[model samples]
Target: MSEIPSTDEALANLSMPLLDAMMTQRAIRRVKPDPVDDAIVVKCIELALRAPTGSNGQNWEFIVVKDQRVKDQLGKRYRQPWSIYGALGRRQAANDASMLKILKAVEWQVEHFSEIPVLVIPCLRGGTRVPYVPTPFVGETSYFGSIYPSVQNLLLAARAMGLGASLITMPLWNVTSARKILGLPLSVTPICVVPLGWPRGRYGPTTRKPVQEVVHLDQYGNRGLTP
Candidate 1:
């Protein structure tokens, strides 16, 4: 009979490649001219499918967009809100150089989304009928809990394969038109659209709120163990 290894032993045997991949992942917007092959995209989709779902329902679907005409239409539709977002970001910048730099990157993304090699739409199987206000209980399982983890897994897998991707939701905000263009059924709702390609830049460390400020103890507001 096979024996199980200790937790420490398992930790010691962890794959360094995967660890590096996880540590180095970043949301890259600018990409190279080299196109991602369809076979590779399919492999990434296969990896995304392996993500666990609530009750193992696996009700996630991926729509790959490669046609330039479709991309152009999406870009045109997306620009309306993108312009508003850019204006808001500029106002928030307040002439701060660093903030302006960040906004510039965002602006570049908005302008060139259609030029990206591949656009992937992650869709949920069922629709939710809830009011604007929060509800006591919605359903057996929430769509976010089932599908978002899969999207994260997809991005991580893409990083490991030397590809880069970013999650974009501006297009999905126009849910009606977006669904019509993609031929998505009424039951299926688009969650996020990811643009994928070979990155033009290198990955960098991510900044976040300190662990001490975020983590909580037994109570909701109580600070957790000190770092």
Candidate 2:
């Protein structure tokens, strides 16, 4: 295990090159239970605020959870859905080593979730005046479109600071229950949960398909300039 850095050392790591951080960022599920500095957690959210929102509405809220009881409640929510999904996943990936590896990591995370140090829940607060009212498709897009960019920013910041973090929505499967658990008003929608702590493993380069394989020129299926 890597030695835990002083808060100053961890904050200074934010100067790491953006490309390096982006390329190496991955869902780090396993982490130590050591308490993270309040300043470090705040800094990650501060950077997250830099991301763009739909119409610049900035209708975002972040709930930083450190309480063990709250974490246990969220863990229960996670397990409720995962029990069924995990069984399905194992059966589906029975013959695929790569997929089985990913499932195993998720299993570990689900089992140890409450023991993780922090849970940052990002939320959205504005849209329809009436809560839970159905909106048109475009309205729907604009409504939920606001939170993801900020989430990417948060993930990138976590990567720069060498914090282990992963974005998961499973714990939020039951919105009504989640709202009650977090004491959120109906206007605020909890988008996803980001679990954070010092890593049990290290961050490294990720494998992905070549850009050319997925990129198209001008329109779909138009491989312009490709010989």
Top-TM-score candidate index: 2
Positional deviation of residue 98's Cα in model 1 after best superposition, in angstroms: 4.4
Which ranges in model 1 have alpha carbons more than 4 Å from their true place? 1-16, 95-98, 130-141
Clashes of each: 0, 0
| TM-score, per-candidate, Cα-based | 0.84, 0.95
- Relative to the true structure, how large is the alpha-carbon lDDT of every model? 0.76, 0.93
- The whole-model C-alpha lDDT of candidate 2 against the native structure comes to 0.93
> What would the per-residue lDDT of candidate 2 be over residues 92-186, giving only the tens digit for each residue?
99999988998998999999999999999999996554557766788878877899899999999999998999999999999999999999998
Return the TM-score for candidate 2, rounded to 2 decimals.
0.95
For candidate 1, lDDT tens digit of each residue in 40-71? 67767887888888789888899999889888
